[model samples]
Target: MPAVQKSGTVLIRAVEGAQGSSRGLEGEVRYVYYNEPVVTRVEPSSGALEGGTMLSLYGRGLEEGSNLTCRFGTGDAVAGRQETSTMATCVAPPRPVKDVVWLQVSLNGGADFSGSAVEYAYEAGATVDEVRPSAGDSGVDGQTVTVIGRHFGSGQGLSCLFGTRGRVRGMPMTSTAVVCVAPRGGPGAVGVSVSNNGVDEGQTRGGFVYSGDLKGKSAFVYYEGPERGGILVSLNGGADFSGSAVEYAYEAGATVDEVRPSAGDSGVDGQTVTVIGRHFGSGQGLSCLFGTRGRVRGMPMTSTAVVCVAPRGGPGAVGVSVSNNGVEGETASGIVSVRYEYRSGMSAKSVGRSEVRTGLGSGSVYSETL
Candidate 1:
């Protein structure tokens, strides 16, 4: 049977005689009213290309039955459920390519679809690059966090996953930015992720930090070093080192005191060098530079010490410096007395061999197998 284009009553009568003969005998007349399904809108008109997005359709003349199905573009129709006279829902089928497809509803299974159609877009997977204001107080909630990345479609059902703890609704401010309220969490750093449909998620490892007692009278320190995680410090400045400490006492600017060995093989890249410093803030973005040769990231061992892998450089001495902000040439502290001499013939192939080494300014010979 053909689909009903308009809603109205239909009358049917069967004639027993030939046409134009005014009929000899007529059968009983039958009357029926037909109502065409109308779909007004579809919520979350966009989803990931993998599909499995439950779509809610709203309109009139939607009936409850077992034959309802939803069709996407030219693909096979999937089953749909009618919840009321004006609402119906169905799961979208997966598409191999990302594109815009027309969504239509069918009351009689896959036989036909509603006259009106809505556009649904299948997008590529989302990704996260950074989260701004990454650190916040654990005791507070509703901190606004801006997530930067790509492929975020505009619609409802967007959410943010704070570690494995829970999710909060996310609002898309742009294609590359999503804003969400940070939920209350325990003190520590946690991974953050964003999802369009709560199924496929994009994550950033160690993207956020929750601090403890940030506004208290006494100073509190929260640190996450490369080797160890989550170290907290509480100190006193009065007699016996017990009392409420002065504000910003421990927030002094970082200072570089010395670097051990102060020398390495110019051709070796993985040689570990230790830097002794003061007031190295406990967080991300710590780095070191070997003069103008190269800048390498440093791992904080404490407020007074940091470890870094020396970068490859030419033979000669270069001023070593540390940048608490992880930026090159933005040295937090450097001294002319502290220098690392990158010597020749100290390549990796020279290891496990006997050699005579001279101590700086000592003029003493030391026999060692390196």
Candidate 2:
């Protein structure tokens, strides 16, 4: 046996013994060249930090074999089943942080190959820790809201979403912050989320509240008696206090004072009850925070009144919250909301007490036949 260092075609002869002459077996052996991999492009040039993107690498001389290994970033990625001499596939690994890592490939224990020809960008997943002015009114359009979180890059791929309204490509203030104009939604609570590179980041720590305050900078026009209404006072340089109004009037937060029919039997699942609280803005923005069952349909009759059907649950104390046009944090500043208690059973006397049932689900009234 002898060493074959160079690539391309070459002649070779085999000998039987260690020191035997090279004429024992005389058959010409032509060596085939194994060229280095030349990568052409990487599909879906970018991916989320959470990984799981199926990446395709197209090039020539990819050199396919069981010993072939392809990696993305500094971490290991699972090699895909579809591999050939011209193309390869792999599942990207999770990237802990945003980066522009290159792809590396090794075949048959040979030297590793990597370069700019195969670059994959690792974008950190979008996260929303907080949404400033967490609440808004459904009537207000293009209401700017500040989103605070991580990996909010200032790129074309960055955008925000309010529930089902779809992505609103926002202006990125920083890698952890963004400013977006709130889209018009129904008078109810909606989830606030962000996305990067077309990948959804899930719901934020809290949701944006749509209230019925009808309070924005445009709402603050002072019509003086004749022509002296403080000269149309502009408290701030910009007369539009829509953003501030949302934060101050509702999003600043609110508290629940009491829930009518506070004490009920386990069978009170479908009963309509009125919730009394401060900052329960009048509008379709009202939603009931019913423990683990999540937000239930409710209506804000006024700043101090909300009507909702009792949520079915086991006998225990459950928290109740009301928001006026989706106020931020769904509570008033410095106010602690009251809780409702569920009892195991109520005597027939309690059930005999006649209480008018207001229709739940939609804020409408229908005749009760019973």
**The best candidate in terms of lDDT:** 1
Which candidate ranks first by TM-score, i.e. highest?
1
Q: lDDT tens digits, residues 257-358, model 2?
A: 877767566655576667777766555556677655456666655556677877777778777776443433332331446777777865543322233333
lDDT of candidate 1 over 1-370, digit per residue (tens): 3456665546566666566875645556544334668888887677777777778988888883347788888775898899999998888778888899888888766766778888888887676666675556565665667877777655666788887557888999998789988887877556677888665555342266665544233343333223222221222321232233212222234566777656777777777777777766546767777787887887766677677788888889988777654532323223334788888886443333222222211121221224
TM-score against native, each model: 0.47, 0.39
lDDT of every model, 2 decimals? 0.65, 0.61
Off by over 4 Å in 1: 1-34, 129-137, 142-149, 153-159, 163-179, 187-191, 196-370
